[model samples]
Target: MKSILLCFGLLFISFLSPDISAVRADYRSASENQEEAEKLYTELASVSDTDEVLLLGYKGATATLMAKYAKGVSAKTAYFKEGKGLIEQAISTAPDNIELRYIRLSVQENAPKIVRYHKEIDEDKQFILDHYPNLKDGETKKYIKGFVSQSASFSEAEKQLF
Candidate 1:
């Protein structure tokens, strides 16, 4: 009977939500590592449209980051456009989500000038600074602070706010 119970417990655990750790991991690593980016992208791809909105945002980030691994400008453009669609969709779904704003800000900050995707950099930065104090997740707050501290997008004075 004990062994049967144990088997049932194991089966129950297996049915729980998947380990979507990539969402919690640093997106910066995905920017530089193709394998990491692909894994993150794949992981986030499993997130349903009805799930947490930020998961979609992370998917967008991973897709955009994947462009770095593409072989040519045209292919890179396709990836960027696809990622941008997902990112924008998430933002539209939850306009006030700070994490989604951060995702967009990071993408805008890093995208090449020719892509003309920098329009939202200042807006997203200010939004983050203003809403950051209200963010509830300690882990996410830490990630945002760390990213801002290192990104050229945020000035030394601005970094202090994070």
Candidate 2:
């Protein structure tokens, strides 16, 4: 009985051991993708022609992935903001782009923390809600409540924007 229990315990430990390796592999892959994204963004920045759509798409996708890999709120916020700016530029360049809009919505949804303005994020929340009203009722209600709760905390200038 003692040998059997020891064998079972060893088997369980073996089963669990690969998860750490997998996590390490994922981190490595994310790092590589981030580097690739930086290179793509540099290339895109140099292009003056309208045919840089593919490069812009690559930049957006990589920015999204970098945001996904961000382990903390500040890192995630930076990546999301960068992605949002790129998406906005892309939209302006192609106003009728449904794909760009979808990617923007995705970034907003997965952001690690809401964009802070004057220690409040209501305007950002409202912008998201305005663009993606089809989000679930519970989500909408939560943002509404957050916006209302935080309204008093905003500065005079911030209040005018909302």
Candidate 3:
């Protein structure tokens, strides 16, 4: 019986082990840890388990961040354009993915006005508001709620939903 119990415990741990290292949570700390962003992006790009759309979105986000650190105009332009292209593909692949929309929203909020990347800001916000309640992941809902609470883009009533 003890051996059987040990086997079950090991199985349980194994089941949870993948989630511990999945790409979904891997990039969540990128904002706070920019130094690791490039490595994380490289590692994530090599992963096949994650949804391709989500992976592409994060890859684009990472490229955008890298663009900020680029030393030359040509390098910066290349990274930014590549990132934008990857994000556009992700959006096209999963138009209704709220998480992807949130990623895009965050990007647009901080992007320069001259870039004209704000076109989807309102649409993404509305989509997030409408779909937030239906999200199944409690942790993600909490993250979104925290984000909304501090975001200038969301109105008072809109923040109340999260």
Candidate 4:
């Protein structure tokens, strides 16, 4: 019975893995396919199996993209505010997460001055740079490398490490 239960659990976990991939896929396509990205984020945001903090961050990112494409000032403001709030919640929940810090830094770097969200750019940039070598995930390291290569926040000296 225990073996049966374990097998079932493993199967269930395997099924859930695709959603994680879907999130990553949608995130990567966000710039080119904002509509699909928004739908994926909205769907994933409600999934109980998804990490709350990650979902929140994804929601924040999707909302930011949505705001960029939104036609009206009111809609843009609402999306930006919602996205910012979700990101802040995620950051507060996982203050030590370098990935979360990176998300915040990216958001802050791009946010308009009117939003007043750029204050954390330097802090998060430093945290990511200081801790880059310690990140064990290959995908994360690749992402950080790609981000730093294009980011204005990282000095040439800092980016050379990647």
Candidate 5:
């Protein structure tokens, strides 16, 4: 119990860095790897009270990834529901955050058809593309472009524009 408490304490402390680049990389990595998902979930699950939109977005994305790996239907639904709620809250809090929109687009693009999370795929894709050139952050623009280039949601011509 002591060790568990200490580990939990340490994990919460790790979130204080608010490193956007780390979270961005983790978002991409955790989306494709179960081990990365577990690590990200562990790191963010204890820090929900944070007002940081990027942190919250990554937390939500990690939750959805964990939902895919969860053992049962109920568990999967619970994870998805919680994660979706966090994501929606974060977007509602920061509608202009391109990173948050990209997070949503990724989730929606890959979400099960039955879950109906794809409503904003086009909107987000267009928003990212239209704003790509004007975005001040080169790394973020590159990340968004990279994802868009590979996204099935975008047309062949649209993908090439990036």
Candidate 6:
């Protein structure tokens, strides 16, 4: 009877272990980082091109950091969307900027596992094909093909631009 009581006490203690506290702390940090990233994104959006190119670079870096944290939290879908939007906006303001394209591709490559928006992907592919179609086929292209084939949205879009 004493052994049984001791065993129950140990089990209860294990259930209230420190690991849970550490996990909660990690979650809180991720949440705080996400909020900071959102703020930086908002500030970047409001800034004009008259600002130094370095400012845009800083914003992109901040966005990427936020995305990394979001991915860690398994909130990747939201992170990718937000990161993509920020990069796209920056690119539009600085069309000749090569760094923007690299940042955009980085976000795309790291995008979390989710239902692919086939229409949007297809439009991007077609645009590339129309201009740089001659580019050699690669693994990324193959993966995208598979995604489009599997995605229901791809079928529903039926050539419509996303």
Better of 2 and 6 by lDDT: 2
Model 1 misplaced stretches (Cα beyond 4 Å):
1-21
RMSD of 3: 5.4
Measured over all alpha carbons after superposition, the RMSD of each candidate to the real structure, in angstroms, is: 3.9, 15.6, 5.4, 2.7, 6.1, 17.6
Clashes of each: 0, 0, 0, 0, 0, 0
Candidate 3 lDDT over 1-162, as tens digits, reads 999999999898555433422544556566556666676666655533244567778778777766766689888788778777888888888898888888888777867676677898999999999999899988778767776787889989878778
In model 3, the worst 10-residue window by lDDT is 15-24
Candidate 5 runs further than 4 Å off: 1-15
Tens digit of lDDT per residue, candidate 5, span 1-162? 999999999898665755778778887888889998999888776656455787888888889999988999999998998888888999989888898899999998889987778788888888887877789988988989888888888899888887
Q: What digit string (tens of lDDT, one per residue) describes model 1 on residues 35-133? A: 988887776666666767887788788888988788899989999998888999999999999889999999998898988888988999999999999
Worst 10 residues of 5 by lDDT: 43-52
Point out where model 2 deviates above 4 Å: 1-51, 71-74, 116-162
Report the alpha-carbon TM-score of model 1 versus the true structure.
0.84
Ranking by TM-score: 5, 1, 4, 3, 2, 6
* Candidate 4 C-alpha lDDT tens digits along 61-97: 7777778778899998998987888888888888888
What TM-score does prediction 3 earn? 0.77
**Model 6: how far is 72 from its true place, Å?**
9.1
The collision pairs in model 4 are none
The lDDT values for all models are 0.83, 0.48, 0.74, 0.77, 0.85, 0.46
- lDDT, candidate 2, 46-153, per-residue tens: 433254442354355456566666789788667766655666677678754333443344444444454531221343444543544444556334433444344443
Q: Which regions of candidate 6 are displaced past 4 Å?
A: 1-50, 57-61, 71-78, 113-162
Q: Against the hidden true structure, what lDDT does model 1 obtain?
A: 0.83
Candidate 2 has a TM-score of 0.37
Error of 2 at 51 (Å): 4.6
Displacement of the residue 155 alpha carbon in candidate 4, Å:
1.7
